[model samples]
Target: MQALQSLADNYNYFITIFLMVSGLYIVIARGNMIKKLIGLAMFQSSVYLLYLSPGKIVGGTAPVLDPAFTVYSNPLPHVLMLTAIVVGVATLALGLALTVRIYEAYGTVNEDQIFARDNKK
Candidate 1:
């Protein structure tokens, strides 16, 4: 009963792990460049969750100069995650632009076809 409760309390970590694994698997198994980009986005989302989960405290207050609050939540993780999100978005956009260029050059987004064409060249 105690173990179950502990697991339930920490379920967010498990979810983060699941997303990370699924994203990695999709990136590895999919041949489509768009699918790989989707997987990379998923992995980035999981990283956000991983940092935010531990920073949440049940009875914590904002880290202001308040003597009444003994427990204060750290804001650093949320701030860093915000920066990470912006960077992730920029990276995704760049990746999509590159994908478009790749398709224009190769006429297909599949890795196998691109490799075959390169071999032929």
Candidate 2:
């Protein structure tokens, strides 16, 4: 009962782990280029969530050098996540562009089909 209660209290951690695993599974199990990209995006999102989860503090104010403010939420995690998001977006765009090029060259985005065709030639 205690374990169950603790699990329920820490639901966000479970959700983050689930998303990470599912994303990895999708990337590994799917052969289609678009699906793989979607999985990569999911994986990236999980990381974003993981980073943001701990940085948030209820009733915490910004880190201002003020005597009135005693509790300040750490801004570093949010800043890092913002940069990570930008990098993730750029990576996703590049991946999509490469997938488009691959589709244009092969007329198919399926990994197995591409490999089979390559083997024949």
- Report the number of the highest-TM-score candidate: 2
Model 1: per-residue Cα lDDT at residue 18? 94
Q: Which pairs clash (backbone N, Cα, C closer than 3 Å) in model 2?
A: none
lDDT of 2 by residue, 32-87 (tens): 98999999888888898898878878788888879998888889999999999999
Per-model TM-score on C-alpha atoms: 0.87, 0.91
What lDDT score belongs to each candidate, Candidate 1 first?
0.94, 0.91
Q: Quote the positional error of residue 89 for candidate 1 in Å.
A: 0.8
Question: Model 2 scores what on Cα lDDT?
Answer: 0.91
Query: Could you tell me the lDDT of residue 41 within candidate 1?
Result: 94
- Per-residue lDDT tens digits for candidate 1, residues 1-121, read 9989988988999899999999998899999999999999999999999999899788998878788889988899989999999999999999999999999999999999999999999
Q: Among all windows of ten consecutive residues in candidate 2, which has the lowest summed lDDT? A: 56-65
